[model samples]
Target: MINILKGMKDRHSDDVKKYDFIMDTAKKIFSKYNFEKIITPILEETELFRRSVGDETDVVSKEMYDFIDKGGRSVTMRPEGTAGVVRAYLEAGFHKADPIVKWYYNGPMYRYEAPQKGRYREFHQVGTEVFGIRNPYLDAEIIKMGCDFLEELGIKDLTVELNSLGNVESRKRYINDLKDFMAQRFDKLSEDSKRRYEKNPLRALDSKDKGDQEQFKDAPKLYDYLDEESREYFEEMKKYLEIMGISYKENPKLVRGLDYYSDTVFEIKSDKLGAQSTVLAGGRYDRLLEIMGKVKIPGIGFAAGMERIAMLMDDSLIKEEKKGVYIIYFNETKEYFIKIADIMRQNNIKINFDYNPKSFNAQIKKANKINVEYVIILGEEEKDENIVTLKNFITGEQKKYSVDEVVNIIK
Candidate 1:
C-alpha cells in the first residue's frame, strides 16, 4: 500500500520545488503585465462547469469528476480554473474593478481521464485571465505572457498558431459551410469525427481519421469566413506579435474545443512533445460572462499546463535544496538532545532527529538516507561542556562548537 501511494504521488518535495519556481516566476511576470493573483477553490458547484465549459465539450461530457456532496448538491473538482475565477469575479463583485482586471491562478485541476506522459488525471496549470476587456492588445498581451513563460523555461523552437472563431453570425455561416464539407466526407471520417459531425462540425478539421484527413485538405478555411472586424482584430494581433519578434503559424483549423471562445483563438506548440503537444492554449471568450449570468463583460486569456512545461524544463536550472540538519544522540542525554533539536527548529533550521531510539549506526544511515547535511553529535563530553560536535557526513569533517555558537551559525 505504501509503495502504491508513493508511485501515485504527484507533488513530491522535488516536484514541489519545480511547481514553486514555475508559479513564483509566472506570478512575477503576470504582475509585471498588470495582472493580480486570484485563487479559487478546488471544488465548486457542478453547474458552474456545465455553463462555463459547455455541456457538450469534453471537459463536461467526459473529463469532469462531478459528484453529489453530503448536502445532496452536485459538486465537481474543477477541471480548469477559469470558470471558478469568473464565478468569483461575479460573486465577489470584482466586476466594478476599473473595467479591466487581469488575474492569474496556479493549482491542481482534476480530470477523469487516462494518464499519459505529461498529461495526468490530476494535473497542474498556470492560468491568466483578463476580464472586462476586448482589446486585441489584451489578447496579444495574454499570448505574449504564455510565450515569455515558455521561453523563460528554456524551451526553444516554439511556434504560436493563431485563429479566429468570429462573431455569432459569421460563426453560424462557417459552421454551416463546415457542416456541408463534413457531410460529403462523413463515410470517410473516424468514428469519433462522425459522432462530432452533428454536434461540433468544426472539430472535424482536427480529425485524425486518414479518410477525413484527405477531405480537410480543401475544407473552407476560417480566414475566408472572418468578418471585417474579426479580420481586423486578427491583423492587429499579428502586428503586435511581429513587433515583439514572436513567430507564429496561422492554423485555420486551430479552433479550441469549447463553446465560449469567439473572435480570437490560439495555441503554442513545442516540437519537444510530438503529436499531443500544446504547451499552452487559450483565446478570447467574449460571450462567456453573458452565458454565465454576468452582463456585457467579454474576456480574453490562456492557460499553460504546468506538468508539460515542467517535463520539458531543464533540470540544471534549479538545484533542489536538501541541506537539512539532523540531531544524532548516543547513549545518554536524551533530554538535552531533544531540547537542542527544539531550539534548532525554533530558529527555522530543518532539524531531523529520529525518535525511534535506535542505535548510532542505524540513525546515521537514516540521516544519510533522508539526505540531511550536518549530523549533530551529542554525547557525554559535548553535553557536559555545553558544546556539540557537528559532522559533515558527506565530507567526514568534524568540528566542535559551543551551543550558542552553533545556534548562531545555524540561524
Candidate 2:
C-alpha cells in the first residue's frame, strides 16, 4: 500500500474536531475586535515571499514548496499567511476600502521541512492583520487579544518575549555592526552562521547552532543601536502593554524570522510544548505594503500555529460530543422511530436513530456508548399507545410521554 507523504499525517474525526474548535474560538474573539475574515489562494508567485519575507530567509531559500507551473511561471505554495494576505489586500483593492482595515484568516500553510511533534510540513495557522494603523497602543491591543484568546483556551503559564528591531535606518546600522562583530570570529562560527553573516546578519542572531549562539554571546545587541525615534516607540509600546496589565520580558536578541518586521516584535511562548514552545508570534511591519505594492501602508499582525495550540490544549476543554437524543427501536418499530426523529429534528432538537436492527439491550448499549443526553425506546406497547419511553441518561429516570410531550421536553 502507498503510504502518506513524510512530514504529513491524516487527521481523524477527533483531531479535526479539535482543530475546528480552535478556529471557531479564534473567529469569535476576532469578531469582537471587528476584524473581518479574509482568505487567499494557497498558490502564489514565488517572488511574493522572496520580496516580503526576505530572499535570503530560510522560508524562501529552503523551506518553500516552489516549482514551475505548466505555464512556465514560477509559483509557490504559501509557507506563511502574511505575505498572501498582503498580496490579496493590494490585488483586490482593499487599500481603497477603510482607513483602518482588520482581517483574520485561518488555513493551511506548506513548507518543506523536518516534521516533529506539533510541527508539520503542511500545518495550519490562524493569523490577524491590521492595516493603516501605527499607534503603539494598537500594537499592545493586538498582543492583549492574542493572550486573551490563549487564556480562553485554558493555556496558562505563557511568557511574552518582546523586542524592538527599530526603523529601517536603525536596523541597517545594527546589521552592519553585527556583521563586523561576527567577522572577527568568522572561523569560530558554524558553516550556516558564516553564510547567514554575509546574507542576513540579523538571522544569525536567531541561529540555533551552538557555536553560533556562543559567538552571539558577546555580539552587540540590537537595542543599543535603536535610533531615538525607535527607542521612544519601543518604550511607548511597553508603556501601553504595562497599562493594559500585560507582563512581558524584553529579549534583546528577539529578531523575528521575517524580513519586514520593524519596531515592536513579540512572541507568546508556553512551556507545555518542548523546544517548539512558541504558540503565537508577530511583529510590526510598517513598510511591507510599500515594498510589495509601492503603496505605503503600516500593518501589524500575529500568526499562531493551529497544530501547536491544539497540541497544548487540554482535551477536557473541548466539548467534543453534542448532547442529543438517541432513538433505539426494534425491527418492527423502525418506521415509527424514524418519524419521531424527524419531528424532533424539525423542532430544532438534535436527534440520532440507530439504523441497524438490534435487540433492546444491544441498542441501549449503543446509545450509552454515544453518551447521548436521552434515549428513546420504540417498543410495541409504546407504538400501540402512540407514546414513547424516554430515559434520561444522566438522571437515570424514565417516563412515558406523548409525541408532542417528548418533542417539548427534548426541545
Candidate 3:
C-alpha cells in the first residue's frame, strides 16, 4: 500500500483546531490594519523566483521544487510568497491603479529540503505586504501589527531582532569586505558554508558552524560598513520602534536568507522552538518590483510560519470555543429528531446528531464519547409529543421542551 511521504503531515483533531485559530486571528488583525487578502497561484514560471528571489540563494539553488512541465516550459511550485505577489502586482498593473496598497495572504509553500520538527517540505505561511511607502514610521507600524498578530495567537516571550542591509551600494561594500575576511579562514569553513561562499558570501556569515563562528568573531560587522544614509535609516527605524514601545535589539549579523531585502530588516524570534526559533521574519525590499517588472516601488512585508506559530501557541491562553449541541435519537425513525435539529439550526444554533438509530443507552454512550455539551433524546413520549428531551451534561439536568422552546434555550 502507498503511504504518506516524509516531511508531510495530516492535520486533524487539535492540529486542525490550531490552524483554524491561526487564520481567524490573522484575518481579524490584518483587517484592522486595512490589509486586503490576495492569493496568487501555487505555481509560476521558474524564472520569476530566479529573478526576484535570486539565483544564488538557497531557496532557488537548492530548495525549490521546479521542473519542465508538459508544455516544455519550466514551471515551479512556489517556494515563497513575495515573488508571486510582486508578479501579480505587475501583471495586474496595480502600480498604476492604486497609489498605495496593503495586501495579506495565507497558503501552502513548497520546498525540497530535509524537515525537522515544525519545518516541512510542504509548509504554510500567513503574511502581509505593503506597497508605495518608505517611511520608517510605516515600518514600525508593520512591526506593531505583526506583534499584535502573534499576541492574538496566545504566543509570548518573543524577541524582536533588527538589522539593516542598506541599499545596493552599502550592501555591496559590506559583501566585498566580508568576502575578504572569510577568504582568510577558507580551510576552516564547513562544506556547505564553503559552497555558499563562492556565489553568495552573505550566507556564510549566517553559518552555524562553531569553527566558522569562531573565525567570524573578528570579522567586520555589516552595520559598521553602512554609509551615512544607511546609518540614519536604520537609526530612525529603531527610534520609531522605541517610541511605539516595541523593544528591539540590534543584531549586526542578522542578514536574512534573501537577496531582495534592503535597508531595515527584522525578525520576531521565540526561544521556545529551540535551534530554529524565528517564527516571523521580513525586511524592506525596495527594488523587488524594479528587479522583476522593472517598476520602481517601495514595499515591506513579513511572513510567519503557520506551523511554527501553531506549535508555539499556548492552548490554555486561547479559550476553547463553545461547541454545538448533539442529538441522540432513541426512536425507530429519526423524523422528530430531524425536525428538532432543523428548527434549532434555523435559529442559529449549531446542531449535531446520530445518523443511525440506536437504543436509548447506546445513544447516550455515543454522546458521552464526544465533546458536545447538550444532548437531546428522542424517546417514545418526546417523539410523539413533538418535543425534545434536552439534557445538560454539565449541570446534570434534563427537561422536556417544545421545538421553539429548545431553540430559545440553545440560542
Candidate 4:
C-alpha cells in the first residue's frame, strides 16, 4: 500500500464532524460581533508572505511552502491568515468600503514544520481582522471575543498573556539594548537563536531553545523603554480590558513572533495543551497595511488553531446525536418506502433509508446502530394494507399507522 504523507493524516468521519461543529460555532459567535466572512485563495504570490509575515520570521524563512509555478511566478501556500486578508483588503478597495471593516475567515494553512501534538504541517485556523480603527476599546473587545470563544467550547484553565512591544522608536531602542545583553552570552545561545540574533534579535526572546531562554534571562524589558506616548497607549488598553472585566497577565517576554505587530500583543494559553499551550494569539499591527499596500489602515486581529481548540474541547459541548427516522424495508416494499421517504423529506423531516434487501433483524440492527429515535418498517403485509409500522426505539412501542399518520408522526 502507498503511504500517507508524514505530516498529514486522513480525518475520519467523526473528526470531520467535529471540525464542522467547531467552524459552525465560531461563525455564530463571530456573527454576533458584526464580523463578515471572507475567504482568500490558499495559493498566493510568495512575495506576499515574505513581505507581510516578514523575511526574518520562521514562518517565511523556514516554514513556508513556496515554489515557482508553471507561469514562472513564485507562489506559496499561505502559512497564516493575516497576510492574505490584508492582500484582499487592499485588492478589493475595502478600505473605502467602510471606516471600520471587520472580517472573519476559516481555512487550511500550509507550513512545513515538524508535526507535533495539536500542531501540523497542514492546519486550520478561524481568525478575525479589524481594519481602519486603532481604538483601545476595540482591542479589549477582540480579547474578550477570544475568551468568549474558548468559554463556549468549555475549555478550562485559560490564561491570557498580554504585552506591549511599544512604538517603532521604543522597540528599536529595546532591540539594541537586548542585542547588547545577548552579545555577552552569545556563546551560550543555540544555533537557531544565533541566526535569529543576527537577523531579528527581538525574535530571540520567543525562542524555545533552553539555553537561549537562559541567555535572555537578564535582557532589558521592552516596557521600560516605552516612550510616554506608547506607555499611555498600553495603559489605556489595559484600562479598557479592565472596564470590560477581562483579566490578563503582563508577560514582558511576550513579543509575538511577527514583525508587523506593535503596541498590544496577547496570547490565550490553556494548561491542557502542554508545551504548545497558546490556543489563540494576535495583536495590533497598526502599520501592516501601510507597509504592504502603501495605505495606512491600523488593524488588530487574532488567529486560533482549530486543531488546538479541538484538543481542549469537551465532547458534551458539541451535541452530535442527531434525531431522525430510519426506514427499514424488504425488497417487495421498496416502492412504498421510497414514497414515504420523499414525503418525510419534503416535510423537512430527517430520514435515513436502508435500501438493503436483508433480514428484518439485520435491518433493525442497522437502525439501532445509527441511534435514530424512530424506525419505520415496511413489509408486504403493511404495503398491501396501505399502512406502515412505526417503532419508537426510545419507548420500545410499536404501532401500525396509515401513510398520512406515519408522515405526521415523523414530522
Q: Put down candidate 3 lDDT per residue, 1-411, tens digits, no spaces.
A: 988888888889888888888988989999999999999999999999999888887788899999999999999999999989988888888899784889999999999999997899999999999998989888888998999999888777779989888888878888888888878888888887788777888777778888888878888888887899888988888898899899988887788656678888889988876754888999899888888878889999999999999889877755676677888775564777777777777787877767776677877787777777898877778877877888998998999988787777777
Clashing pairs in 1: none
Over the full model, what C-alpha lDDT does candidate 1 score relative to the true structure? 0.83
Clashes of each: 0, 0, 0, 0
| The candidate that achieves the highest TM-score relative to the unseen native structure | 4
lDDT of 4: 0.87
Query: Model 3 off-target regions past 4 Å?
Result: 257-259, 274-276
What is the C-alpha lDDT profile of model 2 across 1-411, one tens digit per residue? 999999987998878988888888898889998899998999999899889888877788889999999999999999999999999888888788764789999999999998997789999999999998999899999999999889878888889999999988888888888888989999998888888877777878888888888879988988999899989988998999999999999988788645578898999999976664789999999889999998888999999999988888877877856778888888888778778878888888887766676787888888888889999888989888989999999999999999999888877
Candidate 2 overall Cα lDDT vs. reference? 0.88
Off by over 4 Å in 1: 1-10, 274-276, 357-373, 393-397, 408-411
Structural RMSD, model 2: 2.0
- Whichever of 1 and 2 has more lDDT, that candidate is 2
- Candidate 4 lDDT score at position 79: 95
Candidate 4 residue 187 C-alpha distance from true site, Å: 1.1
**lDDT by residue for model 1 (1-411), tens:** 346421134478778788887887797678889888988999999999999887877788998989999999999999999999899888877776666788898888888877766678778889988888788887787788888888777777888999989888788898898889888867777888878888777877887777778878899988898889989988998898888888888988888666678988999988785664888999998888889975779998888888888887776677667577888886587978987887787878888877765888988888898887688989888889888998877789889998877877665
lDDT per residue for candidate 4 within 58-100, as digits (tens), equals: 8888899999999999999999999999999999898877758
Better of 2 and 4 by lDDT: 2
Among all candidates shown, the one with the greatest lDDT: 2
TM-score of 3: 0.95
Q: Which 10-residue span in candidate 3 carries the lowest summed lDDT?
A: 329-338
